[model samples]
Target: MEFSVMLELLFSGLLFTLEIFVVTLVGALPLGVPVALARMSKHKWLAWIARIYISVMRGTPLMLQLMAIMFGPYYLFHLNMGPDWKYWACGIGFIINYAAYFAEIYRSGLQSIARGQHEAAEVLGYTRAQAFTRIVLPQVVKRVLPAIGNEVITLVKDTSLAFVLGIMEMFSQAKALAASQVSMVPYAIAALIYWVFNFIVEMALTRVEKQLAYYHD
Candidate 1:
């Protein structure tokens, strides 16, 4: 009975974890790419702002972000919200935080392409955007997939941080079950859930990287 209860609690928490992971990626990946471009932009102000956002997010603890995002409206503006708002707030916080890191990852990969490739694209009568999307973007995706895979895995674990915001995410559920049952198994079970999920992510990323292994310059 204890084991079954623990499993149920953990499964419930998994939903919240998955919610955070999905929503954050949905919000962040596209945004991160743009932020990367902005950080690498010719304009000083754009780059500066991007750099500062990245610094603040990367410098601060994620725990702090979780706390501030969850409580900021209530404490600062005295506004209360509904259930969906909790996820939205937490998802936005995680997305903004992770997007900065992803943006830097994107910057490095985008810059890794040989300058000659751009020149060749010009020689072939391709416009800058066309060359970037058709010729350069493929290689950039290949190069960044591995790093992005790592971040995705990290994001899986980071989802547990949502519990700090009173989200009843997997970690929170597991912790509650553990305390109530007075058993170590609930925590161990939660760990297994995370490990298995991460294993699946790693495998999927491995397949993606392999499929793009042509190494074209």
Candidate 2:
């Protein structure tokens, strides 16, 4: 392929990669809140279940998780997945894996909060839900933004793991092209794209951090 043709092909794959990244974040971030709350629940059973879940998700390699999600259904239950299951499995795998990490970050932030804050909210006649939404949640978000940013940066690179499902994400596209053309140029281009992607993410997160800086209590 000509250089321009190669770049265009890779760009097309980058779009698929972006879709995975966005879907994972959109699903995982809010999903993590509940997981974090469950992990910290006063009910022992609920906490134990949540703890085991987080442990398993964090302990396993994400590539293996993707493979399991993609094939386990058919292998274990004899239920056939359609062709589109590739995208579905990738999204689920990424969301669940990232949610585990985000949940821990959230747990740390929630625990770092002072007990006095919750008590004060209650004394002020705020309901538990109201206090959490209005007062506690804001502080937790501010505290956890940097940690979340780190995970998000890692997620950008991890998106390449989608290739295991035969999804032609950026890395997969580059690999195929490099093999056919017998040139390392495609891989070099892919690396440049990835670096640019991470740089943009870092800049965006830095801006968000600055915006939340005023919330220091």
Candidate 3:
């Protein structure tokens, strides 16, 4: 392939990779909060359900989860596995897996807040919702920003795993190009692309962390 053609193919793959990363983050981050809350709920059944979900998701390999999501519906429920199910399965798998990880990070941040803050909020006539949303969640975000940044960076790289389900992400495109050309240059370019992506993520998250630093003393 010509150099320009190779670059175009890689760029196309990168777009798909970014699509997966963005969708996963959008779906997982907010979904994680509720899962975290359920895990910490006073209700034993809710907490137990959340615990089991987190454990199963965390314990299994994401690649396996992706495969399961792609195939499980057909095998378990006798449903059709259509052509477009690849991206849907990939997106759902990434969302659920990352949500489990984020849930734990959220739980840790929530637990780190001093009980006195909750008490103070209540004493000031704040309802539980107001106290949590207004007083508690902001601090949790500040404390958990670094942890979330780490996960966000990981998700960028994990986008390559979409190839396991035959989605042609950047890394997969590079691999195919390298195989066809019998050169490692494509792989090297892919590595550079991944590094640049993570670098951008780190820089953006650093700015977010700084913005939240006002919450500190």
Residues 183-217 of candidate 1: C-alpha lDDT, one tens digit per residue: 88888888988999999999999998888888665
lDDT of 1 at 111: 93
Candidate 3 on 26-128: residue-level lDDT in tens?
9999999999999999999999999999999999999999999999999999999799999999999999999999999999999999999999999999999
**Model 1: pairs clashing at backbone N, Cα or C within 3 Å:** none
Tens digits of per-residue lDDT for model 2 on 1-217?
A: 6889999999999999999999999999999989999999999999999999999999999999999999999999999999999999999999999999999999999999999999999999999999999999888889999899999999999999999999999999999999999999999999999999999999999998888787777
Error of 1 at 19 (Å): 0.9
Better of 1 and 2 by TM-score: 2
Worst 10 residues of 3 by lDDT: 208-217
TM-score of 1: 0.95
Quote each prediction's TM-score. Answer: 0.95, 0.96, 0.96
Q: State model 2's lDDT.
A: 0.95
